[model samples]
Target chain A: MRYAAIEQWSRQQSVLHRRDARAKIGALLAFLIAVSTTAPASRIAFAGYALLLAAAIAAARLPFPALVRRAALVLPVAAGFALVLWFSDERARAVALLEKSFLSAVATLLLVATTPMPELLRALEILHLPRLLVLVIHFLYRYLFVISGQARRMRLAASSRGRLQFRSAAGALAVLFARSWERASGIYRAMLARGFSGQFPALAPPRWRAADAAFFIAAVLASVAVRVAL
Target chain B: MPVIRVRGLRYRYPDGAQALDGVDFDLEPGECVAVLGANGSGKTTFVLHLNGLLEGEGSIEICGLGLKKQNLAQIRSKIGLVFQDSDEQLFMPTLLEDVAFGPMNLGMPREQAVARAQKALELVGMGALLHKAPYHLSSGEKRRAAIAGVLAMEPEILVLDEPTTSLDPPGQRELADLLRALPQAKLLVTHDVFFARALASRAVFFDRGRIAAEGTVEEIVARFNWTQR
Candidate 1:
């Protein structure tokens, strides 16, 4: 259900959503590079990056509160690293770690929010990412929730016990692992039956347009300008 | 000529268990045959060989092409194996992409594959849910989408393993109708006698890796006392 919400968001139409995934990817990369290079001491630079992300989120018509809340998932992990730096007498670096990680997450989230996964993965493949890696990510993203749902049902069945579980789930993590392995084997056989010969095929990849190019150019300029001026 | 031909088929599992032994079978053009057997009687193992998914000591000729390392691609294109679990078969992010997977692998151009996928989806009555993710489909819809995935390959023969496993009566009836209209020679591996009666013109019964009996669905069911009743 949580996965479905993000998928639904990506399918909604907006200017940012309409832009090609490649363009959105390009903007994301530029923003990441800019934020990563900007110093921890540059407070203005961090604000500028945050401003860019907020504007992009707005353009995409995504719910700001939800997006911001989801992006916070990165903070706890970032804060762990930040906490070490703070205790080690590196206060600026601590703040920098949090700022960069959160800003970077929002930027990446913005890209995925606007572009459906298949299109985004196609863009990555078009950019010369390894085909095998793309296929792995494709399957992983598609099946993670399915497997988790199996886990949930397994737990509920245990509760009902009245309940037990699917194929005797019975509170055993090993059962989940075994089930996952079997599920993977079944999927592999299905793939072989459908003529899969190492490469996963997709329908026509999206075409790049002038609008995409313009968007890419503008994003890079804004990101670079912030890094240099701020 | 038979669309599918098998001779002297034998297989032994890695654990030293013999699954299939000295089996011979044939399927005529556009003929649907049901295969019935008790659990672990080699029913699933046998169909896995039709598409060259398993290597065994036998000869398998699908749509006139011999099953071999080099002919696997062609052989697979000739016989679509729809596994029982629709969840495993419909793996793509969306239904349309999943259906298109087969054609694209056969080196059909993307545009042509898209067209074929759309036509196949329409055939299965899933045209409107092109963008729907596989996880969202009801069990019956998932089953149809899985069948559509196979149909897009334009196979000459259809081999469905336990096709009615999770369907309710109405779902089973819908699937039976959809499968009935298909022109491909079909191999139905099922325990559902009523389902077999509805779709298969003839039947084969497997027992401990051998074709123990072959006849009409009623004869096999009666011979084995296979009904739940």
Candidate 2:
């Protein structure tokens, strides 16, 4: 459901959403690299990176509170590593680890929140990402909705009949897996019936305009400036 | 001329169950044929062979082109097979992209493909839902979108498997009307007798992987007691 909400957000019209996926992807990469490479002692650089991401989220018109909450999901995982660093007596590194990972997650979320999945995947394909990897991501995203629906239905059926015990839950999971396998095969056959060879036919590839170039260059330069100066 | 021709088609599952045995069939251009049978009687398998989706020991020709590895892309473009599960067929991020998929595959320009997709969606009465995700659609809307996805390809023949499975009466009626308006040769595999009578002039019954009988829709339905009592 969270992904569904994000998917809907991606379709909304906005200045950031109108930019080509390539520019957003490039900007995301610059932001992540800048956030990750900044020194633990330079708290000002971290603040600068966070400010840039906040500006992007605002420009994209996403709900600030919700986006911030979702980005915090990375904090728990990062805190595990941060705790280790703290016990090992690396106090500054512990705090910086949480800051860097959270910022990276927020920056990555901005890219997905603005660009539709299809366009983002197309951008990855154009950047020479392996075709197989792109295909996997495409199918995974598409089928996640279906598989989750099946799980939800099974849960409802179980609840209607009686409480779901562990044994029954395990059985339901097995059935879900089998059903998903059958569904996947059916989808593959449908794809073949529609003339899908190994690769999806590229929809009209988006043309890279001068504006897209300008956006990418500005993003990269700004990220580099903050990393080097702040 | 026959838009589809098949001869000596035989297929066996990996478990050795014979799904089709020497099945021969044909679809004259602009003819609508209903394939009627009980579950697992080879109706779906026969349709699958038409587009080279399932390779069986048989020969299939679509619009005068032989069904082979080299001719498969062309043959598929000529025969649009809509699966029973609309959920499986509509996999693109949005309805528009899913509908445009076939045209884009055939190497049509993006603008042309999008235009064709939009036209097809309009034909199916889903013009306004182009940006909607497939999961968000009602069952009937999903079915219409799936049909639009195939129609966008402009196939000469349309093959639908168990099309009325999840549809209510109104959805079935709407689909029947849409199918009636299409000019392409149609091969419908369904158990819905009233639906068949509404659209199909002729009918073929499959029993145990072979064509048990073929005749006018009334004759086939009566001979097999196919209608709901």
Docking class of 2: medium
Model 1: per-residue Cα lDDT over B120-139, one tens digit each: 99999999999888887888
lDDT of 2: 0.91
Over 4 Å off in model 1, which ranges?
A: A1-3, A162-171
TM-score of 1: 0.93
What local lDDT does model 1 show for residue B148?
94
Model 2, range A1-230, lDDT digits (tens) per residue? 33477888888888899999999999889888888889998999998988888888888999998998999999999999999999999999999999999999888888888998889998999999999999899899988998998888899899999999999899999999999999999999998889887757666677898888998999999899999999
Clashing pairs in 1: A160-A163
Interface quality of candidate 2 as DockQ: 0.63
